[model samples]
Target: MDIDKIRNSAGSMKIADLKEGDQITGMVTVGEDLYMIANNSVHQIKLADSIDPKRIDPTVPNLQQKIFGKGSDSILVSRTMIFAHEICKGDVFEDSFNKEKIMNISIDLLRCVIDMDECFNIIKLYNKDAMSSVDDRRSVDLSMKLPSLGEKAINGETFFRKLSMSYLLILRTFWAAHNKEVDKIFDRTLDFVSKNYRDDERFIKFIQQLVEFSRMFKDWRNLIEHPKRGEYFKIIDYTYAGNNKISRPMFEVVSKKYPQEPVDLEVNMEKLIDLTISNYESLLCFLCERKLKEIAGYTFKVMEIPLKMRRYPHVRYGIALPTTKGPAPLG
Candidate 1:
């Protein structure tokens, strides 16, 4: 059960042969418990309790004094420290917990949203510029040379697609928000998920699948953002047969497991805003209602399940609405 063996093992391991300064490697459990495999000997160690302070004296200078810092029982273990230990022990790769990777993906998603917003703003500005130019013939020449409004509309559509993809990734990643209103909405969504789907393993697995999707989404985003010269714009249709992508699998698994849930998801900006408001209102009702238990229970059902079950598409291959060419395109 060496480090490689531990790394390859699918399940938990237990070994009792580890000694001080003898490096071990494996996945760290949620509670800081390390599961390691060294030379075919699998073991578990509670990291916080296993390390002897005296062992740190020579290897880590001034460690004991630092541990006793100003009334603290022990020095707090930073996430970086934990990750470093995991990597050094060969339990995790350097890229496993890279903040830059996560941030890059997140920023890529955010940029899509920002780009969409900018595209709309640009359209508005172009309209204003056009109107102003009509009154001033001096500037008419400049306006005539500008790109056609059709081009701008095409760019807007392209940006909207990018934004929709990024928004899906954001929902998948479960990123926290800097905006208070967004934070509230996120918290409410989590609460809804917990209340209605806690017992549903399929839903839980759906969330776990998002980690892989986030990576793919980032790759697709990079392709769109920095495409090679002469490369044509093509949407990666996850719904195509034999595609077997994360999003497709997610849809399949959830739809099969929860037949009542909606299969298609529409990205309506206004509806999302409304849903955020509704989430907050429901949360408030749950907290302040007179019949606390009854109200809270019913509110959870109404807020979480009804809309989801009604609007989500049942099949993965159905055409999305509000498409480029109306009903025919949607079909």
Candidate 2:
């Protein structure tokens, strides 16, 4: 395989027909061994080895050294939980921390991505057509599959809560990255962005749009979390009347901001996931464009394994630094 040719390409491509000294980028799993491809060289690692020095065999020619880099600089990668997007992960602009607050910014982003993934999977699994339709007046009893209508409603509410929390986490962590004081409340972050970044119209507008886009979701989650009032989440299956009135399966809730709203579990949650991802990418681009200029010249690479045949420990993604000499063919 011409590994270098597909480095810049998008999506997962089938990787095969690799010779002993093939120049490859990204990690490839063949049989039981893990191939760490970096800087035009392939380092084959045994499945049984615990990353010991003796277990790393430099498959490239004349490179008998270990597979680790000597650089002291740590690279931060903001990657999608799944390998769906191009330019999976790259460096971020931030400083070292002495006083601790929340988790690492990377882990926070990682959880956000993971929460998106969980919501996506739930939507995929539970997005089934209603078993039967009910009359407008008669009450109908229900008995369905393992994940019944009640379970589906619970799943939807849980997903909205998780996604809303993720949205707030992104805002808080992004704010904490720039300032010394950490703001835990969502309202505080919004106030800070509006007050501090008033001069930067572009930044303020983007943040405002994101907040407005996700406001419905946050309000819905609030009802679920704090049900001290009379608000309750309701689920409705397929319903049809004689005069051509129909309503499909939906999660219904009375919004504190607006009137009673019925949200489609499949459609609305997926839209939220897509928007969250786009919002994060836009924020990352804004930060890099505004703060870090010198780190722009560096080329970036990610370690990817095919999602179809994914293994344990979830080898997320890693950065590859260039070496002094080009990789030689294995003799």
Candidate 3:
């Protein structure tokens, strides 16, 4: 799939003009009632019945899985956003913001993009083919809980899961850029980011959200990578809903030393995804400004685009151009 095209379409906020409302909704019929559920993340649902394996073709779920999760994998990684986490944990980015860090971050960024692109390619095919009827759509949604991803869906899921775990690699990659130690010590990294970019409000807020998210999914890195721990927390039923209002109580293990009653807390997956994109875009734009300042030998600010670009010729297509003299249709 085309990475640029997909990335451009991925961001819900960025693509506001392209589409108006949410594309997909997550829900299941329970005793003749439809209850909405979160788009992504593990959920705890009360199961009523069991399925007989011999009744249906297994391959059906495999094909359906793709359609349900058409653009979910578009939650592609942004180096700067993930790097913001590194900053919160330590003064790493600012301290050794060198060529090595830059190169490694660039590689990680490309990997995320490519990982998402692969998934989206499969998802894109599913969307184009499966949008004909309600039964088709129902199949797409139901297959979200299929035990096996099958061959076609497996590759996409593998890459998507890799992106989830890559946040750790992202931190480690930054650490390895300057340090020799291979030990995955998270505290030091957290320490570095907290110290360095403290003054930057946006940076602090961005990292705090991620830090909180990590707290919720504390063992996510290990859980996803280790085959045995893959189902450490059972996913009762998860529907790959679109960029809708998705929030679920993620089970957070409270330390026995300080046991708390509000152990179960909710997380907004949609907000987290939005923050990830925001952090990435914000940091990326900031870096762009820095680079421009360095190369131009003067402060060259990237001001807002012209009003005309936002209004007439840019947004409206196939219109006659207004030359220096007057509006005219060119041959």
Candidate 4:
């Protein structure tokens, strides 16, 4: 594989190869174990300890030359959690922290809502075609297999799962931004909320709710991302006309706060989706509002999501430059 060529040309790509017999071999030798694609999709082959370290980064510092850094696993990252539209308000701006991190998270929360809406639209087909009439001759309540809708449902699940996971990631990012710490997300988030936003009990509860939701779904998010065999159960709704069985992956989530009833998620995807969306929107709105208020002496403007405007609606903000006449818009 031309790794540098692929990295320079494309971010990622999907490969569609033959079904039965396809072999992939490479002459590139390395020191570490290599995991490569082969013919079988169900099984995998690992060539371990078969390469020389000269093929990899082999810079070794002595024991006394440690410095501050410990170790690093060079991983390929595809996308960031958030990217906010950068805008300058004044010459004095935050040089340390990512200035627009909170707003980027807010935008991602909006994305969560938008993606949930799309997922719901896709899943609606299952309910819509659950009963179909056949040319005025016969009417069947359901079919043994609805390939198209099932496929669409699976795609919808993929979208919902990813977008929801992104929201969870940003939820943790908000904690990192607030608490100035990177580990123990739930604890750090709760500490930040208690120390900073505890003046309003309602707001504190809402923040806590958002944190708890993300923490609960952390493992569930992983399960959805990398699904494994025999890790889930199939749920058959006999109440329906046909034997409609939805093979939902089951995973246990350990919650530090709520430890009462472990509700089965086999039939509660919609409810979980709704909860995630609600928590995301609520928490992001609160954070965005706080961020707006944090700005000083900069009478800027921002268009909130529930915005009603004519064509080309935008958030216009500016920093007034010092001028002889008065104050002018800064470049």
Cα lDDT of model 2 by residue, 17-105, tens digit: 34444544455343344545443223545532333334343332222222332101111112322221122223333453211222334
**Over the stretch 1-331, how does candidate 3's per-residue lDDT look in tens digits?**
4433332343322112112334433333323222222232111232211122332332221111121122221334222322222222212123433434443453455455455456545544543443321132345564322122235444333433544544544444434444434453466655665787666667556555544443434454344345242243222222233653222222222332222232211122323334444444444434433333232232233233233542211111111234554333211
Instruction: Report, for all candidates in order, the number of backbone clashes.
Output: 14, 0, 14, 4
Top TM-score prediction, candidate number: 2
Candidate 4, residues 1-331: lDDT per residue as tens digits? Answer: 5433332353322223324444432111112222222232211122211222232422321111111110111000001111122222233343433444544453345445445545655555454554341122224643443223434545444554654566566665565344354677677777877887867899878767777666545544554555455342122221223344433222243333332233323335566555654454445434433544333665433323211321112222223334455444433
RMSD of each: 22.6, 13.6, 20.0, 14.4
The lDDT values for all models are 0.33, 0.48, 0.36, 0.40
- lDDT for 42 (candidate 1): 30
Model 4 scores a TM of 0.44
TM-score of every candidate: 0.25, 0.52, 0.39, 0.44
Best by lDDT: 2
Model 1 agreement with the true structure over 67-176: per-residue lDDT tens digits: 11111110111111222122122111122233333333333443454455455456557655643432323355632222235455454345535644654535523332
